[model samples]
Target chain A: MSRTQRSLQLAAYADGEVAQAQRAAIEQELAKSPVALREVEDIRAQRAALHRVFIEASPTAELSERIQARIREDRQRASGRTWRIGLASAFAAAAVIMMSVRLIGPELWHQELVSPPPLVARALAVDAVLGAHRVCSTLSDGTAHDEFRVGQKSIVEANRILKALRAMPKEGAALPDLSESKYALSSACACALVSNCEVVHATYNSADGVTLSVWMSDRPLALSGASKLRRVSGEGGRVYQVAEVAGGYSIVQWDERLASVVLCGEMPADQLLKIADRIQPFGSAARPTVGPRVAIVEMALLRRS
Target chain B: MSGKSFEEIALPHLDVLYRYARRLTPDAHAAEDLVQDTYLKAYKAFGKFELREFGVRPWLLKILHNTFLNGEAKKKHAAHSTEPQVLDTARAAAEIGSVEGDLRIDLDGLDDEVKRALEQLSPDFRSILLLWASMELSYQEIAEILSVPIGTVMSRLHRARQQMMTLLADYKFRGRGEPPNGREAT
Candidate 1:
């Protein structure tokens, strides 16, 4: 390597960032020239010292989660529609239940019998829109996913999309322990619970120093005090939730706002309160005592069988 | 794209994102959380993600970088105590199991003078060095994360090394500030 290249390489060499061939060439220079060798070695020392000095610093996990949540929330707002929300909700339901139930998800049955879940519905709409974009991006490149209709340039290439999705590898995460309930969607409230809970699961682990967890959803519908749900509003907006029921557990309810989201779990009221505090612009609190959790709990319980 | 479900797409990048965050933040708690944020952002934008030839790793990294920089830059304007001083803890014998007061680098036989020289560079410089060292990326990819130009990336790396060499040659080791055992020339 020339002297200039060797000098350019010093930082990368200290970092061990260079490729094998490049590294070998640099090493060859070090052997041939004492100055080159001394210079490279000096950079390496600084690199090591810096690592030892700053080994413990990193970004807070909360910021990362918030960013992701912000993106998710933005996308949701962009495709604003009840049907879309419903499908997206259904998907949120399925993903949560898939964690709490059998690997062979029963949401498929729900997909057929019940209207497709909310998250799924939303994605389908987006799939249609993005599918159009995909086709456009494709057609712009001169290759059509399918033979174009003689006059219809606006139509999506549905078959290709379906094929790609089917061929895609699964989206993975740290799944919750689901040995309990079949799916969180057996009841309408369960759907709400899953969405809120999964957001917690997705979000809690990543905040700085503040430990966040999405409590396990136990099956067999064994927990007591589930029937006493109370609806409350927080900084986000009006929250429909259950409170102070069986198991000393309160139902935290609220929307996934741009800056606020309500939570419901078996965790301490203090911790949940702290979560609420961290998320701002919460809506006013409401105590609309929804009908006994009996129907909802019964629905969830029966589905466990 | 459309056909692929959530698990198929987002999970694979978690570990790498975590490792990157860990290095950047240097604090275990902060790194864990930063990694999670990277995932959530990835998940939400999964629909918008297209299969560009450059790949998702870069995209995710770009997001992570933006998120981190946003928070970090905001904090920079916030007031803080005086900068961290050079803490002289007895090179914790258990850490590298040294003899008397010597520093032993188990990863390699490289000596202590080299180790301190590294610590002198700023975090940003160190990050650039690591990105270059990791070899998992090309110059364009590193530029994307660091938000620098291909040419600037080239120049910054050059300057970073020059700084390191100058810093190392001037450093004083222990009390004497001379090479250990007075062996300046190997």
Candidate 2:
């Protein structure tokens, strides 16, 4: 075979779709021709390189946003252009089942919240869009359907709710705070182009060491610092660590100003300040650039919202 | 699926999505755009999402793949460019700077050449290869994305690689001993 034909054959060979006899022929050709062999090598390297460069590229947050928008549109369209059909499931089977629309009225709400229906209703309004059928629609109960709209006040309210939850005692005390922060923070991450940290502290004793992780990605952040501990004139000494991460870095500043460790990482300085500024610790006003308190408030607002 | 609550539910995938977008769309603005589109779509469509049962990587890839393919992008932006804008790739490159444990990578100057060559393939073929590498989607997911039979997805990917090899004839690779073809490595 000529060198040109051999090159094309090499392409086919790389893709693993080449026929058995054809592969034998290519092998025979490769044994004799130096150029044919090189062509085969070139093809392999290129494919691997492409994977390296693009395979790991971060996907757009817009895709999720678009899908969300599509769902909303679909919901609206369904309300208008109903997909009418005979009740196939019930009709085909020997059963007369009638699902009720009163499921979402009030009873189940009280059970899930462990509070009276009035409390949930007073906390925030819940709008459940029912998936309907022909004639009439059945309103089904949803797990968590609360929506948080955009606005500074909305964010502040969400934070307050998050703080209340986080303040609950030891076992999963952080759960409420963590859950609330996710909705609000993810929305922000979507708006901005990167991930943000929800919390960081030495939850572990000295033996357990320090754990730093990017809240969204959950990949452990690599913490390294020349001096892990330092001494202060009046407050004495404390331990601190700086962690390395992709796209940004995190520092457990371990600020002793409040006699409590202040965990601060990379964020828009002004917004971080806004979150930190309002915290009123024990006796003092809520301080800006305050990581733990902000974490507390952010989580609270998320739960309440 | 682990029933780890909302925080643990989707937290694991943030980095993989971020990394995939950075490489697929070379421009930071484009990459950022793609990442946001993927997540926003994922968030709204979370009700339909079932993790592990339906592969998370491929499912996410399908969304991202579709986003780049059908994303309501402006007509003004160029398809792909070679210019090295600092902030866009600086962070991504720095992240993949060294493969720590199990991950092995040799990412360098070859990305532009690959991107340029892949552009020549038909849009369908282009999406197939891009999704294959980025999302690490299997043949099945590619079929779902392009709306082709699984067999067709396989055949097209094979052909796409060949077409890319042919296109590489025009471009150049950074200082390397042999051609990109795997015959040497094999």
Candidate 3:
């Protein structure tokens, strides 16, 4: 056998990886050649050295706790989704009953069924926003969704929506320039979450592929009965409501006069708030930076709004 | 076996996963993130994992390998860089043959030197060496984790050892008995 071939075989033998039949032949050869035997010894020594060096290298003490915490968070989100699904099924049955009554009763009853209770309407709006974000962000066939237009397309669409909102008689929130924040506008879609109300959904993607979606509406969403939402004061004494969504994602919503905005992403509430602070409305004055304590309080105060 | 939770079966391999992740990534933070991503993905797919003779370690490693590769592919696409080069086995074997000597490698007091040698290798070589030397996974298991043929694993392992030996030989001859960077040997 060639010298290199023999060397490799010695390595395998030293590793105890050689087949049974080849092992005896390698042993017989090793007995004849001192050089080959020494090579095997060297391989064994290298492996031992590797073990010694790497055994001293370990992840941080908190790594285990961090992973465990994440798993717990995921499980909680899953259970919450299950509860929401059950509630949604109940709502679906109620809707079917209302539809039957509307069809059999007067025209006024048809109008009442058409315009749902404000709380239920807001819940439906929230569901629609979440659905749009999922459909736009969900990757298909190992590629990003085609509808998630980026670059000039996203920027132009965002500007058009901003202009349309600005032309309206009431003041509206401007789409924040996320360039300084290291996130680019990936897509913007004008979706009608409520009848006659157009909500602009703008998605931003960071360099590391973290997606943040911002939904802007000209009218205030009736968020009073949304479950698990916490209200917190941001920089300009603005009351921002935050909540955890189905996938451990955070949603931060605040009302601007004639404009209501909701920011949603997989980021923690504090990070999302920081992104929110950068999103200045058209005529609002600059506000002082909030502390991490506010974020802690906001997280602690999670309740049905 | 039937009633074991995902954590019961998979959490025991966290250290192994983290060590391998450290070898794959450049920093401690990135390694932690990689391990976290691996665990999350594994937990999601745990329902589909069937217990094999080699147990959950290999399955977790396969997920880690795929996760790392996907991240690497994204990074490459963003940077518009060429694919990483695969080791040329014949040329590596020739080079290994040229380094002819009975120079003793002092395994003692060479931790830093060994780490530096490992760091200097290409990712492919480092991966193969760590799987074989550090994790001590068998050739078939290594092949399974890497999704490569067993013959490819053997050849690549030979190349990895050859490269490691070459780097260690340089350190040995240059540093003599002292450790690299004048640091006291552990």
The candidate maximizing lDDT is 3
- DockQ of each candidate relative to the true complex: 0.08, 0.12, 0.16
Please tell me how candidate 3 rates in CAPRI terms: incorrect
Residue A191, model 1: lDDT of: 15
Global local distance difference test of model 2: 0.39
How close is every model to the real structure, measured as TM-score?
Answer: 0.38, 0.35, 0.52
The per-residue C-alpha lDDT of model 1 at residue B139 equals: 73
List ranges where model 3 is wrong by over 4 Å. A79-305, B83-104, B176-186
Q: Which candidate is the best by TM-score?
A: 3
lDDT of 2 by residue, B1-186 (tens): 555532245446656656655555546677666666565555545554567555565666556655664332212112222121223334433432321111112325557767776655554556667666555455666676555677666655655655565455334322344443422222
Question: What is the TM-score of candidate 1?
Answer: 0.38
Looking at chain B only, the TM-scores across the models are 0.67, 0.60, 0.81
Tell me, per candidate, how large a share of the native contacts it keeps. Answer: 0.09, 0.25, 0.36
Scored against the true structure, residue A77 in model 1 reaches a CA lDDT of 69
Candidate 3 C-alpha lDDT tens digits along A124-161: 33344444455445321112211222335555455544
**What tens-digit string does per-residue lDDT give for candidate 3 at B105-137?**
657777888888888876667788888888879
- What TM value does chain B of candidate 1 have? 0.67
lDDT of each residue in B1-186, candidate 1, tens digit only: 758765456556655666566666746777776666666655655655686866778777766665554344324323221121111112221221221121222223333543454444555555566565433577788787666677777766665544544444344334345553322422
Residue runs of model 1 more than 4 Å from their true location after superposition: A1-6, A9-34, A37-305, B80-120, B164-176, B179-186
Ranking by DockQ: 3, 2, 1
Residue-level lDDT tens digits of model 2 in A1-305: 65334444575676564789889988898899876666566555656777776554444566545544555675675465322212332332222122123233444222323221121101000000000000001001110111221122343343333333232111111211222222222111111001232221111111222211111111112222222323222112333333222333232323222222233333332332332232222213212222233434554555676
